[model samples]
Target: MSSSSQEPQLPVIAVVGPTGSGKSDLGVNLALALNGEVINADALQFYRGMDIGTAKITVEERKGVPHHLLDTMDVTQEASVADFQKDCRAAILDIHSRGKRAILVGGSGLYVRAALDVLEFPGTDPKLRKQLEEECESKGLAPLRARLEELDPVSAARLGDARRVIRALEVHGLTGRPFSSFMPQREYFQPALQIGLEVDREQLRERLALRVHGMVDAGLREEVRGLDAIGLRRGKTASRALGYAQFLRVLDGGMSADAAVEETIVATRQFARRQLTWFRGDPRITWIDWQDPELVPKAVQAVNAASPASA
Candidate 1:
């Protein structure tokens, strides 16, 4: 470490929050003010044809801010957290090399965490994945959870939930080691400054509802139709995006558009709540009250505090 009092320069500035929390707008504004380039952290935004549903910022919307990591993946391709971390690191370094700040903007907390932290996951074993998939079809996730509990209680404890438990167990079955052991205790690699966006539950719900309706009006169904025509299936991650999943139900005649939109609003609100839960636990974050009257000034302060002294 340097003896000087100045802070170390870091590659990225991540602006993260839940959907419709004004993250995109704030990121764009901050980039304009700070001489930064935007790099998207949202998973769904990587799909090329997913526009209105993913709430992807267009060129006009980005206001020529030079956004990266958006529209970089094919809709059918699997884009994992590891892949995103590597890609984002490169993008951040590229921005820094260009003498510009890297602003990471999105609501995907897992993606943001993976990008900023040094994550370690178990080694991949395709045969094990296949076997686990077969077993999931045969017995269920419960049996896998039990196996994981027997093999590695520490990992099981950390991954108590169904989704994580299954994944952890699968990895253990493959690698013959606990998955949690792979998690890196990464030090703060960046002088990161986090800004959490906020809105009232009711207002957010209203916004989500309106946004879903607007997406439908903006040809979301047609977008899905196009993806389907291009062979993007329901099992793919892109197809499971909030609006896409709900609209797929609509397409299948399982639910009406109105009902789907209502369900989507509920789901999105729950997602926002979960995001808030995750972000609130991080002490490193300095929350900016976007709901407050002096949001701009507070945002500016956040930027200044986040910037390296040389900037």
Candidate 2:
């Protein structure tokens, strides 16, 4: 066991992995063991009334541990990692000030990095952004995408959709630098321990499919129906979330509930793969088997080993 020392450590613990990997449960267990509180980093879980689709942990599942940043935004508001970085750091500071360990938990890779890494978000120009948006609306994404490919091929390759492509163009236009140039380095702004859960790929595929089916059974359609009334479709980010986006097709009479469920499962699996690729690129995270029976104890050991005194 690592011993405490007079030299202070920031003492932030992160539980990260692919979707359906039980990160939330592990986070709660680690909190219970280490007397910590959780600060959520999952982007989808930020929306209010998005419980069923996001697979948010219920009150009973929280086991009395205080969770921060869950359901902090309405579905109609756009979720931004830059804004999340501020809120998450504040939550961590407040937790540490209260003499409690801050447990950062979620699968959103960028949000987790934004909280712990030394990342700088570039400033935006409203007028320039408006011009780009107008172009995207009138000429479509291909022209803007082609322009980005010319200016910043790396960013163009990385960004999948029009919103992100346009943002990359805006950033380059404003800063005279490629958006990918702002990629975070492998240094923490604070002392942090990242615990990643590993799973068998085939098993994860099956698990994710079943999980989507479970979400549908848990009234995901009704959940989307409720959010639609609150202008969910108009929300840039929330409207495009995994389960919610697919179910919107059902509401549009474009597909059946079964088709929506299947599409969600497939999309979720692809997303999980992307998440794994992103996390695997970072060498700092300590990976553990998801099925380990002594998971909590192992996580506690990792935390202790990463402490400043242990170092």
Per-residue lDDT of model 1, residues 166-255, tens digit only: 678777777777887767544454556677776677787788778888888899888887887775674379877887888777778898
Clashing pairs in 2: none
Q: Which structure among the candidates has the greatest TM-score?
A: 2
Q: Residues 1-311, candidate 2: write the lDDT tens digits.
A: 15433557756999999999999999999999888999999999999999998899999999999999999999989999999999999999889877788999999999999999999999888999999999999999999999999999999889998888988999999999999999898889899999999999999999999899888888999999999999999999999999999889899999998888888998999999999998998899999999999988999999988875633
For model 1, give the RMSD to the true fold.
3.2
User: Count of backbone clashes for each model?
Assistant: 0, 0
True-structure lDDT of candidate 1: 0.79
User: What C-alpha lDDT do the candidate models reach, one value each?
Assistant: 0.79, 0.92
